[model samples]
Target: MLTVSEKFTAFRIHKDDNNKISSGFEQLSLEQLTAGEVVIKVAYSDINYKDALAATGKGRILRTYPLVGGIDLSGVVIRSEDPRFQSGDKVLVCGAQLSELYDGGYSEFARVKADSVVNLPQGISLRDAMALGTAGYTAALAIQRMEDNGQVPERGPIVVTGATGGVGSFAINMLSNIGYEVIAFTGKTEQAPYLQALGASKLLNRHDIEIGTKPLENAQWGGAIDNVGGETLAWLTRTTHVWGNIASIGLAGGIKLESTVMPFILRGVSLLGINSVEMPLSVRAQGWKRLASDLKPSKLALIAPTTIKFADLPQAFDAYVEGRVTGRTVVEIDASLD
Candidate 1:
């Protein structure tokens, strides 16, 4: 068992009284972390756009100051007050408000709420869990929700917007694995080969396409897994076929939805809002189960090709915030834990 007195390195974010945000590696003991029922010796963590925002102050991500700055982690339980988990069990925590409401995973150790923790599903390593992280988990959740809402291959080809992004990449691979013809809608047409390798059958170049002004344009897609919001999402609403489900996951393009009620009333289209945070434990468990199984991206390596040491984490956020990163980047805290 790890002792509470032992100090470990953590990438911590702090907001000053002047509201200037700064973050760096600092030594901390277990007693200094937020209240939690489970203690984990973290094996791996991963970068998400939210983590970049929190760490760099590019966007406001944390509700409180001076917390560790990773949003996702996978590790082994060294101690647990929760009856559901025991020592030495491998676990993962994603989208449970890490780095937002509670202290996060950018550390050698993590103290997390029991409800936020999940047993690492079979068939994935600790490294694999963080590689998937919240991005992969959210993609899986969007796909699952779409399927539950009657989305099927027969409905039509699934169009994934923000095609070069982490969620978009995973959605493309998972959708294709299950027999759906996947179309990638992206601004980065130069990355056609990368997207195609992830099972995208066609690439819709966002730059060249004309987004028509009609309330309902020609129905082109059976369904959609949208990561870019704003006009791109508006176009999706206008173009998706009857009874097709559009899983709205991100607001990268813009948050304002400028669309008429005609699509919902005339086409019976469903726009399912996909929020990974604050999900029910059962929902989180079921999502992970599927992620370890059918929804697991076959091109996992291609989707998350980079792994950085924990020491390299401070320098990594700038790429993510600048929108220069493609796919996921896993941070290795302790490879031996895998």
Candidate 2:
């Protein structure tokens, strides 16, 4: 077994009196971390919206203060007490209380429960897995749930809101790859070309999607993968086809939904809530397996995730909070591993 580091660099968040929050890299010992069965030498971790929120204190992402802040990690096991995983085995972890109830993936090394981990699927690189991260996995889960509700490419265009973010981008690529015409909605009109390149057949300015007084309208979309909830999701609910599925993922816009039951009661629209954070391991594994196969985008390089070193995360977190970054951003935690 590899000797655990006496001290490791981790980006930590601190909340002080008067509710001000500050974050920076700090040295932490192994004993400071929460207990788990597997110890991983983290090769990479990615910045999700929630991570950004936690790091910047913009949202209620953490239940505790002075915590390491990253929700997604990909790495190789350096030490394992569990038989299911051994030293040198590659794995990935997302959600499952990381960055919330537990110290998370921003550190050079992370000790996590083996049950909360998934063996890295064969044929996917550590970098590539981090590229997908939690965003891509959530996108896959959203699509799978929609498909389970009898959604099909033959139905018509699937509308994706918040189309410039990671989940929306991945949803577009995956839906298009599966032969569904994708209609992407975004406020950043400058990203039209980028969205089109990712297989969005049509692009709607965010302003174009307004929640009208009509309880239901002429259905314009067969289904929807929504990242920006609230008004955008409300609009999608009013516009989706009969028996259509609306996979609700993120709440980038706002949390409250102000809509009537007309869409569900009248048109039989199904609003599928996607909670990637607490999903069972079986579903999480299925999502990752599909992410490696049919849902894996050929244009990941085009997505061009902005990669940064672990130390640069404080600035990266600010960028994410300001909505200045696009696609995904993965942090290279251990240069020697890759």
Best by lDDT: 1
Model 1 CA lDDT for position 266: 100
Q: What lDDT is obtained when candidate 1 is compared to the true structure?
A: 0.94
In candidate 2, stretches whose alpha carbon ends up further than 4 angstroms from where it belongs are none
- Candidate 2 lDDT at 147 equals 96
lDDT of 1 by residue, 202-301 (tens): 9998989899999999999999999989999999999999999999999988999999999999999999999999699999999999999999889999
Clashing pairs in 2: none
TM for every model, in the order presented, reads 0.98, 0.96
How well does candidate 2 score on lDDT at residue 89? Answer: 88
What lDDT score goes with residue 260 in model 2? 92
Candidate achieving the largest TM-score:
1
lDDT score for candidate 2 against the true structure: 0.88
